[model samples]
Target: MFKDSVVIVTGGAQGIGKGIVHAYARQGAKVVIADLNEGLGQQLEQDLLAKGYSVLFVHTDVTKEEEIVHLMQRAVEQYGTIHILINNAGKFQHKSPYDVTFEEWSDLLHTNLTSTFFCAREAAKVMRHNAKGGAIVSLASTRAEMSEPDTEAYTATKGGIVALTHALARSLGPDQITVNCISPGWIETGDYAALRPIDHAQHLSGRVGVPEDIAQACLYLTNPQNNFVTGINITVDGGMTKKMIYEE
Candidate 1:
């Protein structure tokens, strides 16, 4: 469905973002991976190229506006236009609210929340000129609506992403650009083999989610036929949020 399409994914070096990069590339999209991790990003670029996939890795710190501009510029220079953008770069913090300094809070906000807005803005500039418009999907989390201790900063950024998705959808709707977010839960990016059966049982789907699950959601949201479903947040959490637990 994405033949020859130009797709740019921020933080597309590892974890869930890596899954997204592979998904788009497999569908024939010219994928541009924007990430700060040079090692992972460059390695991924080489690996995908080995499979004959078209991809470029741009070392970027999403929290910096200048780097984002450069990332977009580089993509447009190479691909001529951008058809899809996936904002997936973010930081996680777990400091207690009391101990969280202004610097820490501000840094997290810039990394997680501010970067999303700027990336969308820059991408939308190139997208607006497309004949059929474009699509943007961001990585949000279930923590946006629910939270645990020492999650204030992360939760706030996620909630902001949810809100930002709808707003961007409205603002860019005139140009036919669609915006959306996916909220994932318990996506075991590490050591899936180490998880006990009880961990899998916690989810209503009878298993934990993998990066591929969210990658599938991204494909659905950015599909050319599914533009009607914009400005919404899709929670890909294996129905964990729906489960009501009680003390045994």
Candidate 2:
């Protein structure tokens, strides 16, 4: 569906992001993997290239704006211009609100929230010039609305992404750029074999989610025919946010 298009996935070297990279590459898009892990990033690049798909790994620390600038430049240089951008780069932090340092909180915001804005902005600059425009999807979390103990920092940034998605949608509407986000709940990036029955039963879908689940959602939101679905946060969880629980 993404034939000949240029797709950039931040944090594309591992886990959920890696799944997204594979999804786009398989659909015939020129995929750009942006992340700090040189070893994994290059490995993904080589793996995809071996399959005869166009892929490039750009070592990017999303927290750095200059590096973000370089990332977009490198992408365009490699494959004309960018068509889709996946803001999936982020880190997890779980600390009590009382103990979380200001530096730590600020750093998380820069990595998760600020980078989302700037990356979309930079990508939009190139995307606007195209007649067909482009699509951008940010990764939010179900924690944006619900909360667990000592998750203030991470939850705050996710809520910010949910709000930011619609705002950017309005701003970029004139340019024909569609902006949306996905809130994934309980996506197990580790050993699925280790999860017990209760884990699967916790979700309405009767199973825990995998990276490929979120990846398919990204593909749906970014598809050209789905431009009418912009400015929304699509929850990809197995109805976790809608379920109610009472402590025993």
Candidate 3:
């Protein structure tokens, strides 16, 4: 557990980000929910506070460097120090490589790749000074390894994140900061009732992944005692990545 630790989760208002936020809050960490959606962010903040968990929601567009800097400043001001950062603020949108505009491609790169670097840079600034050091976990995707047509933009950024994770881990090793990335596959953020048989059968684990599967991995990677596990990519995709595909 993360008792009394200060943790920041970008895009923490919904989906996998929300699950990670809840997991940390349940373990007594003072969590900063940095998100773009004011309504959902505030609601989640209030909900956690009602349960007597310490949390603060700061509306932040992570693609902008200034907003990210301000968000970190706010977190440190409130919590005194940052102990962990989960860079999960990203969108999955794809277009045909032939039809993707320059603006669209730029936006995708900024959102998924640039934001990851900025957040880690800012968090490491604070963590390096802390005596206990800190940990960072980023969200990549399984699409980075295997992708469908027209997924070039999304795939490129995810692949970038995996490389970024290892590079950052090496740079921050002297400072005792661990950096890691998680690549998730086929995680259905919606109702489990809607899944078809193929969805269940395709994965070697016999089911598609849920947010909690990734969230649990987050907890393990960022745990202070697990300092030995760093610079690695954990694929929480129910063995789908390892399975071979052929026409039946």
lDDT, residue 27, candidate 2 = 96
* Every candidate's lDDT: 0.95, 0.96, 0.95
lDDT of 2 by residue, 1-248 (tens): 89999999999999999999999999999999999999999999999999999999999999999999999999999999999999999999988899999999999999999999999999999999999899999999999999999999999999999999999999999999999999999999999999999999989999999999999999999999999989999898999898878889
Candidate with maximal lDDT = 2
Q: Supply the global lDDT for candidate 2.
A: 0.96
Off by over 4 Å in 3: none
Error of 2 at 193 (Å): 1.3
Q: Could you report the Cα RMSD, in angstroms, for every candidate shown?
A: 0.8, 0.7, 0.8
Kindly indicate the candidate among 2 and 3 with the higher lDDT: 2
Give residue 17's lDDT in candidate 1 (0 to 100): 93
Residue 54 of candidate 3: its Cα lDDT?
A: 100
lDDT of 1: 0.95
Q: Write the residue-wise lDDT of candidate 1 on 2-44 in tens digits.
A: 9999999998999999999999999999999999999999999
On the 0 to 100 scale, the lDDT of residue 175 in model 3 is 95
